[model samples]
Target: GAGVSQTPSNKVTEKGKYVELRCDPISGHTALYWYRQSLGQGPEFLIYFQGTGAADDSGLPNDRFFAVRPEGSVSTLKIQRTERGDSAVYLCASSPGTGVRSGANVLTFGAGSRLTVL
Candidate 1:
């Protein structure tokens, strides 16, 4: 795919279940990000990878959530003990690289993976 790809476009899980979301960034892109969006609200940042390592993960709410970008291309977001409050649309985005401080970098977002916790 020329753009980011998110797997399991939609997922329904019972409370306490564990879920893993996958994302494949555009070829050659070195910057990847994960975000979650609740109804009627903007997406909330989850984590970001500058290459094969995480550049920032402070947006993660707690230890129950984790993400990894091994080899600097494919990434996965893991959620433990899913709760109803965790239900939301998870979005993945990528950029060629973090541009200069001039702010010219633009991110391309995937269609998103919707998760429902019942």
Candidate 2:
């Protein structure tokens, strides 16, 4: 894929159902990130993976939310016990690295998976 690709561009599920959103970052990108965007708020970071390990996951709202990048190129975000409040657009992004010193923090975002809890 030339850019980040997300599955199920739109997902409608009932409360309490589980949802898994998949993200495939561009080849060669080592940094993968997951974010959530509510109605009007900007994207909120959920997790960041550099390589096969999660570099930061403190933004995960709870234990029900988990993300993984087993091979460092593809990632999946799983949400359990979905609630109405969970309705939002799940976004995935990728970059070369954190960009702190390398100045490559630029991120390319996926089209996003809009999850609507009914």
Best by TM-score: 1
Residue pairs whose backbone atoms clash in candidate 2: none
CA deviation > 4 Å runs, candidate 2: none
Could you tell me how far off, in angstroms, the CA of residue 113 lies in candidate 1 after the best superposition? Answer: 0.4
List, residue by residue over 92-113, the lDDT tens digit for candidate 2.
9998886558454789999999
Clashing pairs in 1: none
Error of 1 at 78 (Å): 0.2
What are the per-residue Cα lDDT tens digits for candidate 1 across 4-107? Answer: 89998999999999999999999998999999999999999999999999989999999989998878999999999999999999999998887576147789
Q: How accurate locally, in lDDT, is each candidate?
A: 0.93, 0.93
Model 1 — TM-score against the truth? 0.96
Ten contiguous residues with the weakest lDDT in model 1: 97-106
Q: How accurate is candidate 2 locally (lDDT)?
A: 0.93
RMSD after CA superposition, every candidate:
1.1, 1.2
